[model samples]
Target: MTTTIRNGIMIAAMALALGACASKGAPTSQFDFGPLPAAAPASASSIGAIIVADVTGPAALDTERMHYRLLYSDARQSRPYAYNQWTSTPSQLLTQRIKASLAQAGVKVLSTTDAAASTTVLRMEVEDFAQNFDSATASSGVVRLRASVFRMHRLVDQKTFSRSVPAPSADAAGGARALADASDAVAADLLGWLAALPPSKE
Candidate 1:
């Protein structure tokens, strides 16, 4: 090809790339659910250290994208917010909250990575985690999780906890705050349930 033609093509390609980038605009700002509730009050009896197992859930709820349901449209269909996302998967964030809650309650909390440190394990199965919109003007955050206690690889106790908190606003930020509140409520409930159980078996 002629040098003139080649230079023209290169310039055109560069301009096209620049235009595409500019049209895309700046990246969306990322947001995360707030930290879990403050630690539970200290317990008089010391619970042995326990490891938090990785929480499991469906593909949609298992991800970091903020999910929601439109009750006015398709209550069963789940949708994601393109501009909003979590810092990590919902399960991972919930696991961290649970660990913090337990530790605050005077229980020695170990992470899943520290399996050798404790025989007692707490496994959580997340059932639901999303914002439900009853109308364009109103919404609430909902979270449901089932927790199981295992001692020496054997299931000892299990229970389910669910919570829904009203969103102060109808947008993503409001939904995130409500979800955080719901998560904290669930964590508190789980801690209370664990406190009622007998000490971990050797």
Candidate 2:
């Protein structure tokens, strides 16, 4: 009877230890931003009389793409385990989306490379592109964008936009989905803003 009691105590202690270890292994409830989505399709807008130069931005050396780095307001590691997971290189993805939106609005866009062409130049500077977490729920992803438009070396307009969108609830897919959703929101906001701007004249 004494031997049976001793064995029971030993088994209970081992089970407690194992349970503690499992709890420790779980990932902390921290926010993890993921990569942006592939660029969307261009607009059918007549690319009117306006010619937009190729968008420019800070180099994303990590990805060799122009639009890279999910700029954080504070100094925090972007993701815990994944490097470059949330970074998006600025490419035709954003430009195409903007183009498509403008096309829909019947705005003309010109090419930036053609300096000799007599057309109003539209230059866009993407200041901040990132996904933000809600203070109440860190897991809930929100999209934020800050950008400005320039015409003829003058700042025509600037704005900051944000939106709350559904993110993946599962751990396996959460980060990626957050990134894509954020990008989509940014693109949509940018297009809407551009559509509202007064047409530039040479």
Candidate 3:
């Protein structure tokens, strides 16, 4: 009887200890791009249909981790912020954002699987996507992307777009805002670029 009682007490103690350990870890914060700006009405000049391919990037950016760099200290070393992360990979987020922007501009955004349905394809690759700290108290979010436009599998145009926005603070929250701002800026510029392209013969 005594042995059974002692075993029960030990089990209870172990449960409590495990519970404490599980709850002791810091809580992680998740973020997204937030609401996008209202898109203007589609005009007759807009591209008819397009397929925005899934964005591709370096292996480092393939995860949900939030990345940052201390340019003033060691520019080559990119670090992930603790207890802060994105809802998805940087590539996925940016791809969704670009598709939304294209649809808003009156372009019919199609899926890559619908290749036969569209002649124009837009492919983007991440060149830079991280918050960069220039000093102990100053930081900015920078995003760079190479955009390629293909018509009927033929490359028509390619360009690189970039935006850097000053962070309001030197923390995850600030980085999120700055990055979103930079992303929006780049999307706007891309929208204009798409509008200016020569009218497709198809």
Candidate 4:
């Protein structure tokens, strides 16, 4: 081929590559827990006016990215979706959900910033928060959190809550819905545990 023709073909390929990159750079779609379901009837609680501390999580989950893992291919590597993100960090989302769920159940949920005297405090740490795929077409949202209840600096009790809910679809939207469900399930379990506790001696 002539040198002129070869240069023209190379330039065309570069233009096409740049065009593809620009398309990929389009704005990403953001997500959150969406909305909590219709709450059940509120009931009286012995655990009254408790405080909820901010949730802490690994550095990976400290961002707004939507994370997922392909267990069938590479289980150790977690990847973020190219065109989707979370409206907030995973820890923040969980914090909001837990507080809302507790309030809906008739617990007097208070934030750490709120004034309280010798009130019960709940602290939580995120262990794992990601969508894992069993196969190319199947996945589940998984959440693992460790919670500690304290009163006047004394550890009252500690427990870990976890859930793995199957996604409706294999995409990011499905993952978000599944994670919201799993989070709600965990929050409900935490409520049960809290309710079973005897009134604090304080």
lDDT of 4 by residue, 1-202 (tens): 9999777756754543343234656887788888888765545377787889989989987889887887865799887776788899999999999999999888888888874554789999999999888866688999999999988878989999999999998778889999999999899888888887778776
Q: What digit string (tens of lDDT, one per residue) describes model 2 on residues 64-143?
A: 22111122223242322222232334433456555554555556555666655634555555544433433212334444
Note the Cα lDDT for every prediction shown. 0.78, 0.48, 0.83, 0.84
Model 2 lDDT-worst window of ten:
64-73
CA deviation > 4 Å runs, candidate 2: 1-47, 53-75, 80-92, 104-106, 116-119, 127-142, 170-172
Instruction: Point out where model 1 deviates above 4 Å.
Output: 1-27, 40-46
State residue 94's C-alpha deviation in candidate 4, in Å: 0.4
Query: TM-score, each model?
Result: 0.81, 0.51, 0.85, 0.85
Model 4 pairs whose backbones collide = none
Candidate 4 residue spans exceeding 4 A from truth:
1-23, 41-44
Q: Clashes in model 1: which pairs?
A: none
Best lDDT among the predictions, by candidate number: 4
Clashes of each: 0, 16, 0, 0
lDDT of 1 by residue, 1-202 (tens): 9999777756754543343234345565466666555564656254678888878888876677877777866788877666567888888787777777777777788887898889888899999888898866688999999999998888889999999999998777888899889988888888778777898656
